[model samples]
Target chain A: MTPHDDTQQAQTRAAQEPIAISERELTVMTAHLEEAHQATLPVMHDAIADWDERLRSENDPAELAEMRARFGRPSRRGFLIGAGATLGGLVLAACSSSDGKKSSGPATTNTKAAAGGGLATDLKIAALAAALENTAVATYQAGINAATAGKLGTVPPAIVTFATTVQQQHKDHAAAWNAIITGAGKPAVTGVDTTVNDGVVQPAFAQVTDVAGLAKLALSLEDAAGATYLSVIPVVSDPGGVKTVATIQPVEMQHAAILNFVLGQYPVPNAFAKTDGARTLTDKIG
Target chain B: MTIDEQELAELTSRSRDVHNDAMRETREPLSEIVEVGREHRAHDEIDPLAGREFAKQRNLQLGKRVGLLGGVGIGAALLGLFDQPAFADKPSDIQMLQTSASIEVLAIAAYTAVLGLPFAGSLPAVVQTFVTTTKDQHMQHLQAFNAAATALGGKAQSMADPVLAKVVEAAKPGLTGPGPVLDLAIELENTAAETYVANTGALEDENAKKVTASIMGVEAQHVSVLLAVQALLSGGLVDQIALPPPNLSALPAAAGGVGFPNAFYKTDLARAADEGAVK
Candidate 1:
């Protein structure tokens, strides 16, 4: 045989040579791996437990409560008194006002009853939702800024087309949400550091400096917004408004799915679970 | 009162279906929200794929795509090693890294948010592992960011907010059921992974981008594990895999003008304000 033929034969023989790992042994190995995997989780619980301990021991309940009030439930307390008086007054004022331009303000007479005798908490949720909508609005604006800064002899047609489309969606959502907040007599959630922690917003844009990245960020933010709405919907007093928020959820899910697909990643299923690992679209492959 | 068997089973079924649906379909509903939401906007002006014009013009380029596009021969030659001097011109690298670190902190908060849920007390072993390790990964990511930043002459960050505190509160055992916690974890990890992968192209040092890519990989694994655990706790199959299936980028246009025509949108904030989705 020629040298090439001999080498080829040897390579083929090596490829077929698998004599070890009986079925029983393989099952044991798989079980062991799964066991290890299962066992590795408790360590996480312990850490969370430790965190809970620290929170319970060190955090002043009063101060925590206050913070929760300011950040989490600011409008809830005010809502009980605020809703009845404001909705009637605003609706009248809006009706009397000849300007077809309705109150884009948070107190816009659009009352969606809360899930459990809807109170101020719905307003807070709505405010946060509006805030999120605003953030999304800002993100698309930033995308335009990024594109503008990188002025081109001829910008990529795809980038131009997609960016504009996504931007319009964010704007519309923000406007729609703003109208909701205003009709309720709540202050419109203006764009002032809508990034969750009041951290810089532009850098988030900078980090994901590609069209796909921008799309993904939009999807992520939209998903978070959807979750916020879902979590809040059941608690709102107005079932109709709850229906509106609920309607919004599946749409946000679709946005995330589309963005995930664009980035060569997959969309997640659960809208409410914040920790589902389905968000890691890029990490699963090579 | 604890969630009953029927309730728990329902949660399990829903979570499984959501996971399954995501795996099966290229397009779900969220994109439509964004697409419908931004119908009036313009496009992002910069095209990342334009290679030499849009990207390399910035400064010393070291990302994988940069290497591939600048010159195949040159890129291939420098495949294994990164040139540090090339990164000297860009200060924004530090800013982006810090942004990533901040995101990591946000993740830690989200994963731990379950602590406040009423049912956190009796988390199954698998669910607990999924949550804790995911948090650990976030912590590790924070540390990695710090280490990488320090290596590059940037200081570690120290920003705190009520959001992180709230997340920790949410993570308290027996505070709530596992479903919500899993949901939050998924959202944060997806954001982080997408953010990192997107930035992979911008890093001037190919090595740094590689580091970012590796973190994205880990984050993705975290996603899969979390999905499985949620599925399992809700009584899903142990071997079930939850991924994005077809990535979000490739989805076709939504019917009746619902989803985005493309991913990026470029309208001004003022115009967006006019659109009424935000105030």
Candidate 2:
């Protein structure tokens, strides 16, 4: 059989099999989610505290009460429900039997396909993001290597240093995604998808021989990366996953803004960053 | 529970009166308010049981004076109450938009005031342009937010608040040169960014969360650019842009002075106070 046919058959076989997640795996996933949720609380609490102090200092008891009621404290209920649903969904997805027989209470056969669909979607998205990061790491490394070889003609030393730092950040982002996949009991994608590298990164790299060209390319890449993250966030089911995606998105925007300045463009270009050109690596590759 | 004609008429009258009062306070047209009220009435009719359930959910225990409008359905009265600027007992989506709009107004005013400074004239052309561009962006954001708030049957807040103005005035003495002015801009952008970030988590509507996230991204960009300018003016190389340390102990000497200075952007009050964005 051809490779495409073989892949399709494999997918069909995987879907037909009864999937299961161990209790230990569930515990590990829950722990990761709880840790992420805890990390976000302090940031939120700090904002609420500032508002409280401002209202208190104003001596407006009414407004102070209102502020207190508005953002009292971070509720763990939403996080717990969200995390539970995420784990439950994944578990249900995996435990789904192809025979269409109903499972016992609290785990229905009806939700099996839907939950599995969601988990699959999340995995695909994570893979796409990881692939993009791999491409970014490769791109930056290429630039860095060229600079070291004194072949990045007319590129400023500052831009080279910035590239080195950003390269490491992309590496961290890639590693984070791989960890998420591995933690979910999926095989981690280790390298940049060749199609993405060829279609997007390679074309951009081919056009940039000097500092200005590299800055322009970097701006485009960063903008696309930021836009993709923002777009994917709402679709991601896990709140912890949303937070992880959000944590990295702003840094990409930061990189883009700095590059814009390097290109003599306005740094803060818009009040709302546009996600006009957002595309997953899968989309590009496909 | 079909027809109570007298009670229904009384409810409609009370609704119009309360809505008119809101209109007078906000100086917005009454047609929009009436339209929103009609929409709520339709919703109540569609889900009559939900009206009583919603009322029970609120468990409003206020005095009789602030109670339901002459025995009107709690849902209908609550809808009317939502339009009122004074009734902030419960926070909702529109209130969040208004709060964000108010901050955007403050940003515009702060930028305008900074541009008026004598030192502003001596700054580079690019810096002046940056200030103007950022102020215009804030104005655009304010307009979008105000429109959203008004469309939701709520009053749009003023573009300037005396309270926020006083806060700005308190910081005026520190605006000695371009460096300090840029620092002030950085502080404002940081708060704005954090506020937007915090709201994204708080907002119930998914669209609102996404829109707020988009705004937060731009706000971070503003902070990044401002910090870069601040660094360049201080005779630091552009390569000095380093990531904020993950641990507080490893913080650089000029903590909060660099763009993206924190590994994770904090949305807490303590950080805002430390950053001097608030009192």
Candidate 3:
């Protein structure tokens, strides 16, 4: 580069430095997460209550039984059945079972190829994606709260900025998947994936006492989310669904890469993105 | 880290299938080529006329099986669309594989050159580790793509991307420190990541799409780390950039947000799929 160009490059590099974030910016960055929990959360609960009652009042036994027969699951499907089966066969699949049949040669060589096929599998995956997004959003929010309360002690400014920024992105991811769900005339998933919540997040997060601990906990979630997206893209039948998840996946990887740096690890740990951390598609949920 | 047993099994199965297919494809042709070579070597002078006759026969028989060699061999160079037997009717997957291998080749070359630089000697230990590990990864990626391509009846493109090789050459003279080299590395990585993201959707083969997407994730991670390092070097925190930070708390706040600027990785910087195809 010329002397003039070098001067410009220096200026560009300087511009990349983090500036002091305003309190309002941080709050906005967190999406007013406290207010979201205190105020909007109850509103969601109340609305869900009314929605649930309405469905129960109009509940049809024959349709519910048919939904059970078709879906054959209790946890994830009952909700979908209760929400109504206008989307009956169009939603849910034995994806976890079918996905198991395909060889990983890990993403292809579907020699046994058990996928029930099209839109149903995509919807199931969409539900799982939304749940995972909700899980991430909640995890970041908890991290922000713990830091703010001084429970983790002296949180770094850049990390706070990352939390606010990244959690909002997760919220956006959740909304994107929900939009696809509701667009199909089903209710949006408003909660985290319970399988992940109970088995992984809650158990691991309970041990987080310091910033390093919190960072590690968060990294696991980010890693799983990124890997899950990688596994889903090939099997998801719809072109739109594939595109939506593909776009969000790099962002998840970016999240993990940053976390790797905070924990004093090589940011890019593997040459190929691994599915070892990919969330298992349980016979029930998650 | 979580373990998905089924995913692991499938991964094993995938590796086995690729291995079996590669071995299966090459076993016969390799043997024929060897037999031909022995026949030729037995001749006292290996007559020029006889060599010419063998060449005509070899091209007719084993050329398609062995694939037109690339720069690393006889002609791993570009084959006409109709000439590729496995993917002749569908060359997009072959193009993606060839172009990816080309980029990996260029990455390996760039890092190898940087590692030998006078300034590179003084780079932070962690940075040195990053450079070496990333170079090795690119080598592995090159081998994987070439293996897949050769298995699919396409030539293994062991050549660096012609377009970006020139870009790296033009910038190498300006590399006063790790920062400048990091800039070049980051540029190549971001382009590869974005291109792979684009490739995932456009690739017709299911396995190819997943493989491309999987590698895209790693490339994106590389871009993230390099971006973070760029920020640190710019901030003059070279001493603080350790693998296990002497003090993670002392690392600047900017380190957190600097790594990931885009919520969605963009494809605007991606190279065209066939841009580096060995044509």
Candidate 4:
């Protein structure tokens, strides 16, 4: 007999000998079951416990209220346990419908929802990302022009070489983003968005012209660009686009770190990039 | 019209079958939800519960059969949960963090040994400064990883002395001058960067991934500076102007350089080596 036939026979045999569980023992059995569940899924237990702690400690009235509304009150362990039991019931129903025959196919389907927004939002985000890259290109160009014109007084030649290399990378990034946007049939942005240049870049440049100043400006630009990519990754509709952004973001952070080192700071300052609370892509482009 | 004993037994058996079936269907989705919950909890973010409502609805439909089965269904469900893939694997996050901490420990030991080398004192002041600063950073990283691991209920891992010995021994062949020493530093930084990148995706905790990536960014920067220093020491920048520039002349000819080496960072070298991917 085939393995499938064996499985069918075993399932049929099991179905005939149902355990007669008394209703009075249900609670005790459930407690045992919950214990087994926790032992089996300790990571999940820890996660749920962590969430519970957060919910209890949340101080903001509005945020606390929101959490309560979404997840119910913080002290709802009993309710959660009940929910788990209910879910088990549902699984049993499904199994019964299939006559207790488990499919030999792959167990889990991809659960990720389709990208968060529509194509238009994707285009907007892509354009904004492209704009940030363009600004980086332009900023680097401006720095290079200053160095060539001898405006960066006493800046080392090696520093100029470094800036030139970094500038080329920004150009590559800009081109890549433009390709992504144009490939989507969106009108490619023609030039660097001066909004970021005016608001952040120029002001930064006006404050410093030496190698130190240039490094500072470059660092800020890289930080902001990195932050923007990070902010957009979760919101972008295209999985490919999200992957692209994730790939690019590390490079930007790398640039920031190198610049930090150039300015006589620790290369790895923080354990995580300060991507939160930074300007968004829209904020930068506008 | 009274039900016979056979009929009652058959009814009970059918109810048990339904209960068992529902238990089977619920396991996979619940496990997924738990995984998502773990990730969100790590990040201190809200659980999205994107697919949770469907599971709930399915359970609600089976509510009557569930009532009949009493705690039997719960017992079966727990059994199913135990069989889930998420539970099947060992807790990888703590293990990964412990591994990372051990790597950091290795780094600290290697750097400390390098500093203690006879020729190290005569190296350029900038080189000395770089070595000390980097070593301090590794020490900090080691402490941080240990703290994180401990907080996660995992034991802190110390640097494997044998691994450190092996690394130092490997560098002995090139210890003749500062040039070789710098090259070795570059190699170590690249490996660290590649390891962090490769392992970042395997991390179950979002915060752990972020921490790893942040360290990776630093490692990449270290590679860049080390490459630049190597170029300077080699008399002049040869082939440094190429877009994405060539890897440091010290590195193998096939290796890519400091200028954003690849569109996507290559990962898994360190991990693969650790898992005996290397002969």
Considering every candidate listed, which one attains the maximal DockQ? Answer: 3
- Greater TM-score among 2 and 3 belongs to 3
Q: Sort by DockQ, best first: what order?
A: 3, 2, 4, 1
**In DockQ, how does model 2 score against the reference complex?**
0.11
Tens-digit lDDT string for candidate 4 (A1-286): 4323433343333334332222223334334433432332332233224333333443356543432332221221111001221110000011212221112111100001211244444444555566667677667666665655568775443354355446656665665565654454334543444456666776788776676788888888888777666445445544445445555677787777567655654444443444432343223232
RMSD to native, candidate 1: 26.8
* Candidate 4 error regions (>4 Å): A1-126, A153-156, A182-195, A206-212, A227-243, A257-272, A282-286, B1-88, B146-155, B159-168, B202-204, B236-264, B268-270, B273-279
Give each candidate's interface RMSD in Å: 21.0, 18.2, 9.3, 28.0
- Between candidates 2 and 4, which one is better according to DockQ? 2
lDDT of 3 at A253: 91
Show the colliding residue pairs in model 4.
A91-B21, A91-B22, A91-B23, A92-B21, A92-B22, A92-B23, A93-B22, A95-B21, B247-B257
CA lDDT, candidate 1, residue A219? 66
Record all residue pairs in model 2 with backbone atoms less than 3 Å apart, i.e. clashing. Answer: A19-A94, A46-B268, A46-B269, A47-B267, A47-B268, A47-B269, A50-B269
Error of 4 at B195 (Å): 2.0
TM-score of each: 0.31, 0.60, 0.68, 0.53
Rank by TM-score (best first): 3, 2, 4, 1
lDDT agreement with native, every candidate: 0.40, 0.52, 0.61, 0.48
Give candidate 1 misplaced runs (Cα > 4 Å): A1-117, A151-156, A192-197, A268-286, B1-279
